[model samples]
Target chain A: MRYAFFPGCSLETTAWDFDRSVRAVCRTLGITLEDIPDWVCCGSTPAHTSNASLAVALPVMTLQKAKHMGCPVMTACASCYSRLRTANHKVCSDPDERQRAERVTGKPYDGSVEVRHVVDVLVNDFGLDNIRARVKRSLSGVRVASYYGCLLTRPPEIVAFDNPEHPSCMDDLFKAAGAEAVEWPYRTECCGAGLSMTEPDAVNRLGHKLVSMARQAGADCIAVACPLCQLNLDLRQADAAKAYGAVLPTPVLYVTQLLGLALGLSVGELGFNALTVSADSVLQRCEMVVSAGRGGRP
Target chain B: MENRLESTGTSFLDEVQRRSGTPISACFQCHKCSTGCPIGPEMDVLSSQIMRLIHLGEEKEVLESQGIWMCASCEACSTRCPMGIDIAGVMDTLRMMAVERKVAPPDARAKHFAHSFLQSVRHHGRVYEMGMLVAYKFRSRDFFTDMDKGPKMLMKKKLAFLPIRSGAASEVKEVFKRVEEEKEQ
Candidate 1:
């Protein structure tokens, strides 16, 4: 299967590991991703939080470029997916805005191009059953908390992908890879997304709550689909502990990283070491690594 | 932290409606938005109270309160609201209005960060994390805040030194120009 990929700005910088693991996992699954030519930033939280028109225009520009690829546009970052989808919705739903945006974008965006998250592509487009067929060394006995920290599913009408209240796509994805997804609340809670650095105190408090909830539920590692979520849970975990007074070595991992490991991809290939909390001890306990002579199935 | 509740010449509700396109009259004070909000406790005015303030045309109070900045825009309130009011979107509208009116200071660095981030994207087509954060420090005048995060993220190779500009610089510029024109209208 071939598709156009729009790795937003975060992927190139802070979430570089997410970008790497996404490519590595797709290579194993035989999914070819073509880079959208002249692709720009998705406008992120800055655009919407400041000006409405810029938010609509920035993503529309990229989505317009993705249309040339004539396939689904996949995004690794949840914030990018939300921005792109919001732009698509605005132009499709309003004729006046569409006419105005057409003048700016130089194309009619009837919202034809499908903007999707990578996890959605894996579970629905690629089929979880098909993905399960490729797992050679499964992550048996490893308990994972599927963390969906807003954007992939919110303001249901705009995103229209998963259940807003309680999402299960990530859970099914982890289970297919042979890891038991522990049921936990606060999966869709806010993680102080754009304020991680600016307002460190509030973010640390929020992160502390999320980590404490996950640890209380007995998750060995936290799996997320969004870059900001992974950063707050993994990188700022120490600050969260210091603020909220719970110290657990709960690792935060990207969903693809966990799935890639189960698919027999090496730790390095999946960017496992990028995580602040170490996954070595947990993976060792689960006996996930195959011998040096044997690799995952091709 | 009280703002002088003054009568405005322009309709405050109309101003919010013009910016966000969310109907303030639809909110029936269900308080569901407040109950579902994760950061409601941290907020000084809470979500439902902000909606009421908007209705009452307490423009200064609505903009000055930490509630709007505290909102993470998780859409939890937007999704759970019985009347289908986009409380989160309204929060965005309030934040932008606050910034436009130059009311945000000290408490809402998130607003300043967004402005700096937009400046970086307008220049480079994507975010240079180190560059954007540095510029935000200068703009917000909080240079020491979150400075410790630098060395660690740099060591992890999370902060790229240089930004890669693609072929869409002119197009992005045109888009920003149009947005500004739209705001004027």
Candidate 2:
């Protein structure tokens, strides 16, 4: 499978581990992801809230470039996926918006480029059967709470991928990887995406609820698809726990990282050292960590 | 709490309906939107109340309300809405209108965060996290925000020391410029 990859900004910095695991896992699966050259920010939440036209224009500019690549645009960041898909929807359905976009960018373009998230590519294109065959290490004992968060599945008409209310793609992937996918109610809960820096209290409150519930559901760790979600749930996990008086840490792993571990990739390869809440206990539970060493490299 | 419909005779509900293109009029005040809102507790005005306020033509209340700024834009409300009104989309439109009209947003930090984020995109084509965070801190003047975690993140090599400048930065700037020009026109 070949795709024009738009890793988005968060992958470059805060969520580099997610980017690393995504690339490693895709490489193993024989999926070719060609980075869309010169892809800019998708104008995430800020643009959408500040100016509607700029939000549409930014993604349209990138989609216009991806259209020439002769492949679907793939992104791991849920925010990027939502923005791109929303832009495509508007550009195709609304003539006035399309005209304005063309007039602004000075490029005549139809929103024909298809956008897919990494999870969508894995679950649908690769097929769970094919992925199951590739799993070298079975995550039998490790219970995973697959946290979809908001962007990947919501605004159903725009995203149009997976069930918006109760998405099972990530859970399906977990089962394929031989991990026990725990049932959790907060799968599609908001992690307070952009509010992390502005109103962290809200982020903490929401994050705390997610972590507490995941624990209640018997999950050793939380798996996420969005960088912002990972950052909020993992980075601020301690603060969230402290604020809400929930018992200690819950490791947050990217869906790619979880799959990477099941694919027999080492902790070093998946960049597990970067995770704030250590995934050591979970790794040990899955028997991915034989030795009681710090770095759980196989 | 008494808000008389302005004699200025502009229908705030009509304006929102036009801009968002969502059937705001179809909302029957079921409060489903507010009920599903993840950040509803933090909101000064409930999502359903905002819709009601708009229906009542309380433009100033809806624009200046903390609820619009506090919306996580999760679309939970939009997803579960029985009337098919894009509640999240309406929130987006209201936020843009508030910014455009300089409605003295209740949350200054939210305003600064949005500005800081967009400013980073305009300059670097993509977000330079450290630069954007610093700018946001300085502007919002909340210096101690997440200060404790900075060292740990840096130590883990999670924080990029310098910006990863995008290849087509100038083209990105052009996109921003064109959008701004169109908006002005």
What's the TM-score of each model vs. the native? 0.94, 0.96
Task: Give the per-residue lDDT digits (tens) of candidate 2, residues B50-141.
Answer: 98888888888988888888888899999999999999999989988888899956445777888898999999889998898899888888
Q: Tell me the spans in candidate 1 whose CA falls farther than 4 Å from its real position.
A: A288-298, B1-10
Tell me how candidate 1 scores on lDDT.
Answer: 0.83
lDDT string for model 2 (A77-109, tens) is 999999999999999999998998898778987
Please give, for residues B80-181, the per-residue lDDT of candidate 1 as tens digits: 888878888999999988888888756587777888898888887777777888888887789886667788888777887888775787788777777787
lDDT of each: 0.83, 0.89
Give the number of the best model, judged by lDDT: 2
- lDDT at A252, model 1: 90
Fnat scores for every prediction: 0.76, 0.87
- Candidate 2 residue runs with Cα over 4 Å from true position: A290-298, B1-9
Clashing pairs in 1: none
Over A1-298, each residue of candidate 1 has an lDDT whose tens digit, in order, gives 8889999888887887798889999999999989898898988888888887787888888988988889999999999999998888998888877777787767667777898889989998899999899998788888999999989899799887789988999999889988899999989999988877677788888888888888889888889999999998888888788778976879899988888888878877876656778787667856855333232212
Best by DockQ: 2
Model 2: lDDT equals 0.89
The local lDDT score (0 to 100) that residue A240 gets in candidate 2 is 87
